[model samples]
Target: MGSSYQLQQQAIDAEIRSLEGSIRALKLRRNTFAPISSLPNEVIAIIFSFLRARVTLFAIKPGKKPDGLAWLRVAHVCHQWREIALNQPHFWSHVDFTAVSSAGAAEILSRAKTVPLHLEVGAPVGLWDDARFGPFQKELQDRVPHICRLAISAEPFHLHRILKGLIMPAPTLEFLSLASENDHRGGAAFVPDSLFDGSTPRLSSLELWNCDISWMSPLLGSLKHLEIRSPFKWPSLSVWLDALDQMPQLKTLALHRASPVAPWGLIPSEVERAVTLPSLTHFEVSSPARYCGFALAHLILPALTSLCVVAESSRRDYSDVQEILTFVSRHAHGPQDSRPLQSVLVRSNGMGVEIVAWTSPDVHVELSEQISVSDARHSGRVSFSITNSDDWSPRVDTGTLSAVMEALPLDGLVTFTAQNRFNRQFWLWHAPKWPLLRHVRLTPAAERGFREMLMEDNKRRGGPLLPLLKTLVLVDVALLERRNLRLCDALTKRVEQGVPLETLDLRKCLATGHAIELLSKIVVDVLAPEKTYETGSDLVSEAGARLIYVEDEYSEVEDYDEDDADTGSDDEVQDMDGDTSSDIYGEGEAVYW
Candidate 1:
């Protein structure tokens, strides 16, 4: 009986082993018939490339752990995928040193097999002395010759160490980005003069933040896109011109706080002949007004389609502003002169002033948010921004606003959008400047001044202001009884003066039924709520209306009185309008009111 039991146990164990083998064989067979398995190797590699791009983008987000190799997990899905991933040399060529262990780096390098590499290395935060950093530095040193794109962000000391070992030639390199993080803690890191042995023949895009490179470096010769921020030293104006002269093919140039300090008595007349950048289409600069003016005065961008100048000074000087305006006037026309300035957005508040002009008629500009240079570039817009140096100040200097508005080329402007507050007298004086202006969009704070401008224009013996104006959009307004009557009176007067508005769009406005009815009779088309929503009954009281309006008005104004020049009291009944500031700008396309 014991022998029989042993035999049965042995048979059961053998059967179990047999079943496992059969299952393994079935899985292999199943994989063979899978739809993905039928794809060509090249197609599979393409699919992997897409996944790699997406994963790489997410991995680069601030404060996120470096996981450059995370895309390789697809290989672990199955044996077939593993084989495909392993066979593609290009798939292994991108090595982010931070994501790999020393041993893993060696394996990846071996698998890459002489393929040009794209390397990314970021020093670990607060752990620049980590033991693993040594291996990364060594790998970068050994792999410099094969690197095609290298982007590294490190603290100054670590960056110096890594760059010190990269003296070898990088024949295949095309893009290079070196940013020194936490640079404010100490002096900036300087790029070694011997970097790449000055032999990066194919480099086209170069970006450096808190890193300084020689203005005369040979690497500048081939760059098509150049960006430098917070450089350790600003080269002389002549040196900058010489460097730019070497980069004839440069398409995009961004200099943030990187301009040379203007000579004590520097003026536009003192600037030498401008260096012409024939190929440059996008130019952006952020610096003190004087520095920006000095830089622009030295360069001529004939092909420039997008220009963004952010002036960060509060010195009350208009000379720099004049220089910037002159630069804009020179390059205001669109490519090949096919498009001309058609829409203008002007935003002024206590913080500063922003002016955005688009050659395209259909461009919509948001009021409450700042517009970035890149955003303006892609949208074919030109923007000028002046931020108040003192945050506690109630408003930008009145002179600064006047200089910018007076210098604006508004002869052909057809659509005008003004937000926040402007000096009432200033608007009245400049209202007739836009001869071709047809559409006007205003925030509640801006509406009173504009309305008064229209009324003043009607009384003008010469002609009316914004004579071609046809559409009016009032945003975030409160149309109580008195305000309604005033607005209706203004529109009625405009009609009598032969400058009648065609459409009146009230967006996100608190309006009484009677107010909407009165506006409907004046405007050809009045866009407002049909139901009568009383301002003070259960929903909102007169005091409640004041609070609502004041709250929205003060949203952009910090520590400012409600009676400031830009805002009005609630009892006066400011005209009613609706929508967030963004909605007033339209979401997808320009909405002509």
Candidate 2:
């Protein structure tokens, strides 16, 4: 009888717990349906806009249901939310019929009403069946007037076929980017002449890739940004100038692999007058050397802030560089002829040299030479190198550098770099010309010549070569010789005299531990080579003084390949493991090559 009573007591306890849970659930349900749930439709719509989904609508293929979307989530929240969402036409203005069924497309269009649309439409690659795009094309044709932005990427043939006889009613269109997709035949498509019927008055941005469009098209008058890539044939210089004259408001222009009507070797007997692009601020041209040369010579841009010139073939000509200097000389003048250029970056490879300026990197220039310039975001750097030939003279480089120095205002220059084969003696002689320079980076060969200048400055006892230099970075500088030691002593004396020599980075240097430690005692921060060597501070100097020992190790020689370096192009850079390149310079540090 006692055991039966215990089991009955446990059953009563279980029943009490179940009743408590039921009461808590009832309270939660009551809170969910409180009076605050009756929000105004306008308030609900504003909130929904904040939570609206941004997706590539064209990525949704036909017959596939899009699950877990923001609009769907809101509609399923409650009956009130469902009613509000279904009634708001703007909520469904962005339609992707490519992924949904015909019935779904119809409902979306009906709900969107007459609101402006941003359409991403095209028959995806490999869908040769015209039946697949019947419903999609019909909807696009009907909604042509409402599309403000159109981005289409499809085969040229298919694109032409879709809009052959259809008149585009795109009066409100502002931006249009059309590109050929997977055209293995090198994008030789003849664009229809009457495609837009001379419409698109409001089109300000136009980009055409691998499609031939007449330069005389009246529809191109209002374009502000223009890019033509892989044209079927090069237009004559006169024709190019005529087309440019029409687009007076063009701000940015880019031409890639665009041929010229004139053949390479024959110069036109009649020279076309240069076009004055008062509004153009950024320009880029990549073509054969002759074509690039002619274009640079004939274009006059008083407002050009950024420029990129890519010579596809290897042939050293100073006229192109001279033309660039002349163009800069014309624009780089204030009322009193103040130098407008703040910085000039010049880089060279085995083939040739590339010279650029630091107004902005709105323009990307690629050349056969491995010269490059980054935008304002990253530090602007230019690297120059030449073939290691004894007979190769620096005359060409001398003229180039002289032209650059004359064209730029060096009063604002803070950082400078003279790297491999950069006419070291020439730079050393001219080092004192710029007084405000603070940071300097030099390679092993360049540093050798720089040591002489430092010694000359030390002898003066007052003026220094770089008086304001605080941090020094030297690449592949080995302090194994007596002369190198004296140079270090001179630098140490400069630091002792309150020049603020805070950091000394001796990258890939060959030096004894005692030598490094002795140098470290003089300088605040010393980055010696990471090498395994004797660690002793008892090395007797030439003056018979013992110095602290520092253990140093040598790392593998870092090789620099021009082709492998980042040219700052739109193309993404990836490593063998699929990782991308990262920024090398940190905040507050100067960028030098």
Candidate 3:
């Protein structure tokens, strides 16, 4: 017992000694560090403030190390950090409780103090019920009037209670994003005008996804930016189009992503005359693959600096290219001060191709590329967009694609983008030589045609195929059964032609070992002839491109069905412009091999 008492006394003595040492150091060092300690409090506070806000309150689940996660990890470093974190009330408002717990939520809200909050709740339907939120609900209700922004993503049933329970109004709320990934969860009743009543006098922006709302009420007056997706199934587009007529202050409007196959043509003027929105400047509309159907020129904003149309391409050939071309022509900036209708993105969903143009002409392509000896020599980042470059389809081959690339002016383009722009069969005249070409993006089907095109048999008076081709990118390449003369044969032919092929990059997409074996042949043949093709178990093909191949094994899933492939939505309606919406497109017949 005497020995145990000695041990406990020794621990107490050590703690007391440490405290005395700290006190002695503080008293002696106060004068020496006075200048540093006297630094501006606001600046010191900012430095500490930065440390506090770095704590991440929410991370995207299945969380990879993104910026959000990195920021959150910075908070747990030390004791000083924990103190600075609790002191800054604004830091608590940015708390994202997507995958956090209820208790964690209360802690976050508590730390936020009385500062206006920005709350984003992304929880599954069952997780955020009125009962589940009962404890925080009342507290949130009490704090609602102080909230600056509130974004809640829940089902329709829960949304009703949430809207009703919102502490009798947030007059300062400025932004709201409400939706459910599960479409059936939101409807008109959940978004009654009373939700955006005078209490929310400052609400300026609204974004909806898979929300079902009829905009027949008086919620349209002061909105500056209004975005709607899946406009109806809450009812119809007409309900909101009716409200837009009265929104005099509206500046930006984004329509729902229309069905790829739906007969959505240029809406005529008479239909648009219902509302005169003189203040509108930015407009985004989703169209079917082709640009033929709908017209929006009548409501064209005189002050419009940017116009974006995401059109579905029905006719792969140049039938309505003129219509889209004309729309672009009509909307191009006239004044030098005007924004140069700059970017255009054409993505193919199903067979219905989408053409979305960005109005800022000065913008570079958003796609990345390989830097060449030449690009490095020039300087800076080389961005490329599929829509800006040549044809970027997943079902086309690189070697054969060169022919299509022949039509573009490639003097300034990078080699790979220049090569892909004309996916496979690049005509000899266009690429006379591959300067920037590095990779070719394609699917297994294109791989087959590519192999066949390179066969000693496919002699069509063309020289060697894709001599400069190096890599192949499969963005959404699906892992499916093989159809081939082998990727080995394809690589070997490039080698035989003395063409140097290097990497077959399909990092984002997957293929089989057997497919990998074929790609691995570049070293044996093209890269270093002394090397041999080492086979592996990888599939060659991936599926993002719309494809339909008539072969031994066929499944509805394997077929690249255009969104237009099969649907009862084909029954058409005439637009206000006296144009037959169905004239340009008809039924989808089986495509023969």
Candidate 4:
């Protein structure tokens, strides 16, 4: 009887617990919830006023389901939430005319008041069907000056409404980006030519992407930056180049070509036009160089400072680098009238055809070993990175380095990298001590540290070992295996005894489960896996440090496409694993290389 009574008591307890949970949930959902007025009105206004572009008609939300007057019910369910949402008029300013019924458009307008409004219409069918968009148009036209920004697709009616209509000049317009095209036979297909003849003066930034234009003239005299991306619709590079030539105040320019044009050489000629801009500082161009038949045989930009060439849908041609050098040498010649460029950058960008910045002359090298580039150009800052996997024969490399060492202003060359051949004889030699190495990069097979016999090898040539090295970049290394320790230990010992190495960049090198252990034994000050987080100290130097882990500085390949369900251009790029690249730079450390 005692055991049975205990069981009965437990059953009663369970029933009581279930009842309490239901009661709590009902309390949270019902009209019993607290009122928004309960909080200070200032707090409520601050919270709701900032939700402009995001909160549209509360009656229709993105990917959310509501059955039968749910919004009104929420207001009626509890008085507080309704009051907070209702009092916030600015929250209802943006009207997304996507799903809202035509009959209710006027009702939404009534709530919007005279405030500046943003209207986004996705379905183009509503353009001419005045029954649907007439009320919304009336609201937008009334507040044209307040419409600081507008994004509309190409359709005859949209063009007529926005362009042809007596559109008041939007003086406050700071940015205008259009991908104008038309499905209607008479839409603004030739609209840019007819409507945009240097008319919009206040527009400071323009991005033309696949925009068809008979005449590419733009009123961008005050424009500071311009981006033109793969205009498959464009006929000639002349229209674009002419537009740029007219813009006297342009500071930065980015050019990207997507398709194969009939006259491929036009773009190369157009790039040469940029040499005319005395104010042009930063220029990045991505195009097919091979099709650009002209070798930049003779040209120079006296004012050019930063240059980035990314080959897009095009392979890198050795001739491109040759052309640039020849042009710079010829046009920027003479010790008296040379414009010294502070930064130079070139990249093939993709894995296809390679860009050869360093070429083996027919004679293997020019024997002049004492080249003074500053006497020739005066601009001391030079940064060059070329990626190509070619057979740089030992003799050719020695000759090339001899030429490079002669040509380069070594002390001024702060950052440099040449990644292709690891077994080149130069790797086996050329200690940076002559220049007192600051930054050095060696490929996978090029092991760090010299063996005893190797020192004797350098001695035979009287080449000094680099002792004051501060930084080293070792990439594409297969150092995870135990056999690799032979090299790792050698590097560690050299750093501790010979070189006062402070920083190491090991980008894209693999790491095993016991990576820290292997590295700890071989390197000084190796941060333990448990202590892998970055310290708050700048120049985090520990005296007598043996070995430490410096994060690799290589690009991490992304294995994107999360759902396998949607890989469209619109879906945000996602990785199966969380973002693999999260290493941030140290706060105040000066990166010398």
Candidate 5:
């Protein structure tokens, strides 16, 4: 009886297995008839490539590992997808050891076949210790000849070992980036002379962070892009010049705290010869003002289209500021002098001061439209930023800033934007320098001082200040009570002098009904916020108070975007007014009370 029962159970299990097989067959057949399955194999492979391309292995937060293999879920969707993904060697060419387990790494390597691999390893700090990294290290050592791009972020000891293992020639390598996870200066890793056995012919881009290499390394010969941050040691000025002379094809060079230290008793005549970088278009340096000035004095960039200098100091004297300004004045002309300076924006606060000059008026239009300058691409720009580290709430050095403005070649400037607070004296003193200025945008903090300057200029017996000024923009300012009356009086004086403003824009400002009436009467066209809060009873609405508070918070902040200088083409100016048609700023007609 027991045998009979066992036989019955076995028979039932066999039938269940048969049913499962049938079910899988039916699903496969159904998938074949689906819309996506009808796509040609090559088209399907292209779609898969795009999906894989979107998954990157960078920028993972702390205490987390990269999951770049998530795109492989497409292979599990159907049998056909699995076959297609396995057949395409390029799909599995990128192997991130930290993201995959030991078995998974083997599978990826097997599937990649002979395709040139783009390898990323040892990121997110604590993941790649010596024990767990041994097998992968061996694999990388064997595959160095096939790597196209390699980026590794590891601690000093581990990086040293990894570099020692990479002694073979890497003829296929094009891009290489090495970073030390340890922040201590003493913990920087040393690059061995045998790296790629000094035989990387295709190398074009190299970035080293906290790594020390010889200045005359063969790997630095023909690089097009070079970025070094926090190097183990700073070379002398002459050594840097010699290294730069080797890379005439370099297009972008960025150094963060990696510039040469200032030598004592250095005279201008000692380093009269400047290393000319003819192909350099974008140059950036962040260091002490003295070091930055010393570095800029020794290099000549004839093809430079973008320049960025960030100077930080604790001294009261601003001689370094003058040196930097001199460099900018020399290079303000765009590449080959094809584009001239057209717009300038100055932003200052307790923490720092930033000045940006562009060769196109459209940058001002884009700023007026509230597009972040950091995201825009342009051809010509010169930017400067200086900060004081002694005091967080220190007063702005108007004396130094005035010199900076005076040094700028503003004869061709057409648009100017001033943000944050500047004392009345600063504006009154420098207002006349911008004779060709046509468009001006002033933030809330700047509005009062600028109004005072205009009023004071009216009192003088000379010509009107900013005689070419056509458009005036007041952003996040309060136009209520006494402030409104004083500003209107200033505008009335301008109108009386026969230099009426063509357009008046009040953006995100709280104004009483009487204020808009007075402004509309003086300006030909008024652009006010869509929703205006009339504070007739001296009671502010919640939203209006919130706006004022936000503006106040931003008043002491440095709002300059560095990326704006390196981007934006000549064609982007055509769409600068794309946001003007929106209802946020109301119609182009006057706003009645």
Candidate 6:
């Protein structure tokens, strides 16, 4: 009987093996007829374009297999894909000389045939000294005329040699960006006019970082977009006007850290006259805290729709802020310029202070050091931002923020979004009122401040602060029952006082189900009934932008106020337009407000 059992087992094993073989064969046949393999070359070409779009090719290490290049992976997929990719000249147009394999780049160049090339040539840190760049340099010389868009970030010496080697003008070049690999503050290499023999008429957009160019360079004549950064020699105000005058079609101009050669406001009278840019629409300037307003003070942009100014200073400098405010007031109220500013963005991050304010035609005003913008024109809402700055040295004095608020119209403001705790401090200090404010979005830190501000107003019998505020949006804020009971009480008191907060939307909030239930009884509508939801990871808030600090050595946490009873009497609603006094972080500390 044992022998019979062994024989039976052997027979079963043989049957299983036979079945497995048949299954393998079937799978192979099915894969051979797979839908993807049967796709037409035209269809595959479209798929290849989508896959290879925006790919930045880098030089492949000698022995290591290239990993990130999508074209290489596609070519290796199958013979058909390789053939289709190699035959398409446009597919090989964008070449990154820095990371491309010596042999691989040549192959791509050959396949690229007569297609307009977009070349990026740069070597990272240690690779700048490598001998492999010799061949790539020669290839670049051969391909310059065909290059339509070129971006080079290399050692200044290497850049100089490369530009010097261009024996012919790049007739096809339209956009050019040349930047130094090293940080050479005031020692940028001078780009000689003879590099292109004063040719390059098609160039419309030019960006230079840590490089020198003559103000009279022919390249500036037809440029529509010009960006100059950390120029070695600060061009005289008159030189700037002359250069701008040559570019009739210039629309967007940005000058970053380009201070005047002379002291601030000492430009010659001729250069000081405002030069009008008829086609200019967007203007951006960032300069040292002391001279952030230098460029705008010298130019006039009548068609300007968007303006962004960032004043950066390492030490305390109030002059920069004052200059910015003065510049805006002068241009915004000028009678000759009837165009209402569609948007205004001003920020100062220097020393120990940070302040950001953004306003547009549709939205009235936003103020706080933390960045946030709300686009609720359809809903008629405005937003605000706030954040705590550690190492708060009070540099780049924000006294200008209050002045900015006073200069703008805030009566129609409807929505306010607050981000960080310090924003609450800014708000309490400013005590600005928007009679039409109806919706408010708050983080936990700001929530406490909001409650306190509202409770302070509830104490007095005068017109309420934010009387029309009906909706409250809480984002990623936790409510502790023991400590935050007063928050609920404040809402209850405000509701009882007639300015009822109709909706309480708990979004991505960490509140206990019981706490949410309790709050539901107070507010008419409570969102997030589930009491839990993942917070949105979007850094950009509803307001459009928010400023975040990566490193702040000092931060403090305050306990939530749990007291439900109104302990203090209401303070009369102070006029937002008038100067108001309030304690800053300490009893006697004075702030910009």
lDDT of each residue in 115-151, candidate 4, tens digit only: 5554444445435466655665665566555554444
Backbone Cα, N, C clashes tallied per candidate: 14, 14, 58, 12, 4, 17
lDDT of 2 by residue, 56-149 (tens): 4333223443331356687876656788788988787766545566678768888888887766655567665766566767877788787776
- CA lDDT of 224 in candidate 1? 97
lDDT digits (tens) for residues 315-375 of candidate 1: 5443445556655555555444566678877776345666778876645555655544235
Ranking by TM-score: 5, 1, 6, 2, 3, 4
In angstroms, the error of model 1 at 157 is 0.4
lDDT, candidate 6, 1-593, per-residue tens: 99999999999999999999899688657655878978888998989987865633222112342333565578876557788887888888887776678787888788888788887766664565546777778888888788888778777777777778876788888888888667443245667777566678788898887788998888788899998887767778788778888887998887776755436553232343767888887666666544545666777777765555555533343433544555644443333333333322232323333322324333323433222322221112111111222356453223445455544444545555544343334555544446666777665545655676766553443666777778877765555555347668878888777887899887555555667767888888888635331233343342221122111112222333324334212223344333433323333322331
**What is the clash tally of candidate 3?**
58
Computed on alpha carbons, the lDDT of every model, listed in order, comes to: 0.72, 0.57, 0.46, 0.40, 0.72, 0.60
> 371 in model 6: Cα distance from truth in Å?
12
Model 5: what TM-score?
0.83
Candidate 3 lDDT by residue in tens digits, 304-354: 544555443334332343344434444434342233222322222232222
Native-referenced Cα lDDT, model 6: 0.60
Give model 4's TM-score versus the native structure: 0.51
The estimated TM-scores of all candidates read 0.81, 0.63, 0.54, 0.51, 0.83, 0.73
Q: Return the top candidate by lDDT.
A: 1
Write one digit per residue (lDDT tens) for candidate 5, span 1-593.
99999999999999999999999999999998899989999999999887875434333223355466677898998889989988998898888876677678878888888899888876455556666788888888888888988888887878888899999999999888888778353476887778999999999998887888888888999799998888878888888999999999999998887788876543353366689899999888888777777777788898888877777765655555555566556665544766667788777533677778887874653443433544332334777778766654344455567667766777777887877555455554556666788888877656655776676544443788788888988876766555677778888888887788889888656666777888899898988766566533355664555455343342332121112323211111112122321111212211100
Estimate the TM-score for candidate 6: 0.73
Please identify model 3 stretches exceeding 4 Å from their true place: 1-38, 49-82, 128-131, 181-189, 196-198, 216-218, 234-242, 257-281, 287-298, 311-351, 356-593
